[model samples]
Target chain A: MTSNAAGAGTISYEQAGVNYDLIDPLKVAAQRAAAATAGHLAGHGFTEVKASRGESAYVVDVGPFYLASIVECLGSKALVADEMGKLTGRSYYAGIAQDTIAMAVNDLITVGATPLVVQAYWAAGGSDWFGDAQRAQALVEGWKKACDTCGVAWGGGETPALAGIVEGGRIDLAASCTGIIQPKERLSVGDRLGAGDAIVLLASSGIHANGLSLARKLVERLPQGYMTPLADGSLYGEALLAPTVLYSPVTEALERAGVRPHYCANVTGHGWRKLLRHPAQLTYRIDALPRVPEVLRFIQQHAQQDDREAYSTLNMGAGFALFVDAADGQKCVDVARGLGIEAVVAGRVEAGPKQLLIEPLGIRFGDDDLQLR
Target chain B: MTSNAAGAGTISYEQAGVNYDLIDPLKVAAQRAAAATAGHLAGHGFTEVKASRGESAYVVDVGPFYLASIVECLGSKALVADEMGKLTGRSYYAGIAQDTIAMAVNDLITVGATPLVVQAYWAAGGSDWFGDAQRAQALVEGWKKACDTCGVAWGGGETPALAGIVEGGRIDLAASCTGIIQPKERLSVGDRLGAGDAIVLLASSGIHANGLSLARKLVERLPQGYMTPLADGSLYGEALLAPTVLYSPVTEALERAGVRPHYCANVTGHGWRKLLRHPAQLTYRIDALPRVPEVLRFIQQHAQQDDREAYSTLNMGAGFALFVDAADGQKCVDVARGLGIEAVVAGRVEAGPKQLLIEPLGIRFGDDDLQLR
Candidate 1:
């Protein structure tokens, strides 16, 4: 089942047409520029939490509480829904809504913040894109359901009909969430991340939302497209459209149990390499990895991607990762299980060069692979 | 000179290919579906301020404070920057940044909220789009400048490189803001929009982000494209790319002066028709309208649009509108004047059917023109 056995040459994400190498520098520049405007919050009686920049979300210190904010998009996954709808006549927007909400609130929870409200930004290519009542209703219901799942209010949003910038018949979905971390003790900024912390991996529903452009490229090569059957007998696109796992409940559960994570990372664009996102030079050594979802395996096979490339770009199977004290690892897994989520103590933090080592697949991501700090 | 003298006949926004008639129903349906999820806020010790649902932003009552949140985009205005850059060999993203931020924080201040943090969502067509240092630096500097102008923190954001959904070589910019209203009495929910409230008009710099698609289509017919000159001698594209006025300052000034507005509306998209956005059957009579900016007049002349069509589809000159008690009208205008923004008492709210009357131009927008509830 391992993609390493394919013996295919390494296919870097850049080869598939997305080069994070070019984007990281711009992000770094934007962070430095944004940091200069931190003084503006002083007049509002709020202080900027400097360390929150370049992390999953921005944290601001109000008088009585800390607010975490994040703005994220569903990426090109909405196109998957569009293509699937054209083929199956069933709207996959419910999953699209979940993916969009998951992208925002999931990042919010990484800072130990409870999402208070989520506002959506749906930009369509044209006005007639919403003429399909079934599709529109699914989007609305799915957005509300995702909000209910995360226990946040469905704040109002803007739906602009951008006729030219966006492609016709497709919508670019993005959301922003404001979350609150009360008492401030629950904040996970990696200040407490140290050697001997346990690494826990939470199972993903499928590809989640990353590497979708490559996935679509693979679909184009498939003879049957979305109808292509996998070993499990499900259509390729159906498996890819599985609703993202909402990890906010895991954080909420840990808060109720009085367990604080040293750091948390949503395994998204950078895949499992996100496990080493902490600022400190600590190695995340994975002795055991979660089972790769069938959808990801199908993508790797169809895309002819080797293990090192696939693991570095796609979520594989781990949707989220938590670093906590070694003794609390079992309790974290038990909490996730209580909530019907499959989680395991897959690895541990070690005092070494910042890197991620997936021993089973013999895959290693060097420190240079992730340069967010 | 008024565009009505051109005798070019009416040029509806729909004629330029943007039909709000098709988008409004979907928005109405979305509002109804979103209303059902308001109850979820109760679990977080917050109650939904139901009136805020269909307004410019959503308000949530959290303990002693009310929070206002909004998500909005810059529409196709960035395309103007791209096209201008191609012609002028200079980046115009700084103005694009201001327009995006203004679109979000301006709506927030309508409900009397002071912006605390604004997050950005910049989705590019490809990752390398940011490789252009001039464009990236301009976007960063402009975004920071807008944050400083609005007196809010430059919160974190996502810059996803959407390869297909967004047009290549251009970026789609959007922003979301979270603001706080303390002591709750400052909330402006239109309940106080009485018959005698004075209508105050704030001068716009030019076409501030709305109707850009139409503006671009007009450019296609021009002999010189972005270089075409208007009466002011500035290029048509440069005039149209004028940075949007951040009205958060006007609201902040009014709040500091203890002059509460009955209601506020950002004059975008629906243009002057937005003046009748309140759910009351009141007539907004404009005895005097702001002078049309040269950019809008140029558009009207070239597109062969009449005054009725131009004013109803574009801001013309009014950028923001505020309704205050007839007695406090001068004070509100004085507050804006103190901030270096020109404001005038242009009209009065009268008890009648929902409509907008521009006396100087002899134009009227019946209730049928704007159907948003």
Candidate 2:
């Protein structure tokens, strides 16, 4: 219900303690500094993928293959899992681990790379956090399951107990993934995106990994807190704790079908506003929308957000988007279906200003709303 | 001075809220699960080097070359930088960033891999943490400088603001590094380790990214806190915040000289106990010891710790140790000196019990001390 960082006309996310106005500048500065260090790669016989600077992943042009890397953290979602576990007497850490891996691997695959290895970074406030055998076992099992599902080696990790940095009994979960793009032609960063490219959407299970700061904030105002029930009778916190949909397999299926998208967008922190994440100045027009999950509908209703605000701040339904030739849209959807994932041709790109138009919701997001670089 | 987790007969690090007894089993379990997923790499034409599982870095055999990866965090070193910056009117984040980079890159090179790319993970408690342009810019410059120093590309990173998980105004710094090892003979994981190999010690600038939890705790007992001066007249915290040495150059130089060590150990976390980190069961005999840095000497004196506990916990002097042929002992030391890094023929490896014997100090650490796997 709060505005996403990329589209913050309101102060909700700022009130939630994440202010993009202050954070985005630092990102831009880091990008500039990072650009200057590209020359260092050449010494190792690897060239920097110049266009991958602000993309979801950083690509390195190693001979015979391109390597894409990403480092991502699951923001505050574990807090909800902890609270819900206390009330339900069941540990949700398995799902929490899956969500963490999905957050990183999803971003790495955005550059048309196949994830090969994933490393976990789990920092707990105290070592006692792992004394809970069920929780620890669940985390281990989930991490392994996620690696197996994504077809990436569980390439070791670091689990440090950060006493003073993290809050007691709490943890901060993160992961870094390295993927490979072979044959060179598989690389995608929107350079191949055309005006008439069809926009294919892969449905999200729920909130996935973004906007948890606002959702957790909204929980405090509800009388029942996490126990509040939605119209579908699911607990609010449990609904929000749903494991994120891992799209690595979907991308793999498309790769096998040779239906590569010109560009792919992982609908994460920026919500639907991420639809225009590419540097291309094309307009994305969505003629139809997926049914908003009941949990998201409840959040929008309780947060008192209008259609535009809700769509711009949360992944109302779609989680991953792929811009491909109009002829390949249905084929992309069919590939996803083959993997038991729902997908649809949601819209198409047009020759216009850089913006996203959700025609069904009568919502519009201009280029200025989302400035990553 | 407390006992290292690998040799914790005392409860210093435990009192610091990092109880390894509870955390190590979880790590063992995660490693077991990880070992099960090595097959996942075969799908991508990469094979996990089984021996690399419990080592400092994970290695993948990719036919013509091997890729080594490591994930490491700077722990609470940044908290010291934060406090020092507030106390001194100068920001030390550039060094802090370098320390963070060193933590990961140092581990990567232990497998004899030349670092190729490093991705950073900076998780702040709140967005306001980056509002300080000086601190932010210092971090940016430091990261670029460190990447340039290591000759690796500054791959993209993620900066998340986790308000509830991380402490307010604090940040958790971690990084993942991917490196290359060509010719396959360059890989060193103790398989080549043998008796009579000389032990070469690389002098640490100071405490390099380990035992910081206890170091930060000891500050509470000091009346002047971080401002307390050492015998050498340097501020206690500033010395503690000194940048960790980047050992990548030493490894590179040794490689260029065609003098590959049988094994290398980044003396971290476990202190001198890390000297025998290789699983060869050989006794490591140290006849000479490097002069302990003044700051570490001050820590031992103030904390009322004897030589045994101090050496078992803090770096005591040597930051890195390499085991090689007796003929190459002085050559290794000379290589480090050529790069402006002090080194000495500190010890030798013997075909004896699995233990570390500090000859001058009459100290002995049995095999039971350190249990990484």
Each model's total of backbone clashes: 0, 1
Model 1: pairs clashing at backbone N, Cα or C within 3 Å: none
Clashing pairs in 2: B6-B369
Q: Compose the digit string of candidate 2's lDDT tens values, residues B61-122.
A: 87777878878988988888888988998999999999999999989988889998899899
Q: For model 2, how does the per-residue alpha-carbon lDDT over A62-125 read when each residue is reduced to its tens digit? A: 7878878878899899999999989998999999999999999999989999988899899998
In model 1, state the lDDT of residue A42: 83
Q: After superposition, how far is residue B215 of candidate 1 from its true place, in Å?
A: 2.1
lDDT of 1 by residue, A153-251 (tens): 878787888766787887899988988887688788888889999999989999998888777767656779888999999999999899889999899
TM-score result, candidate 1: 0.94
In model 2, how large is the Cα lDDT of residue A318? Answer: 93
lDDT of each: 0.86, 0.88
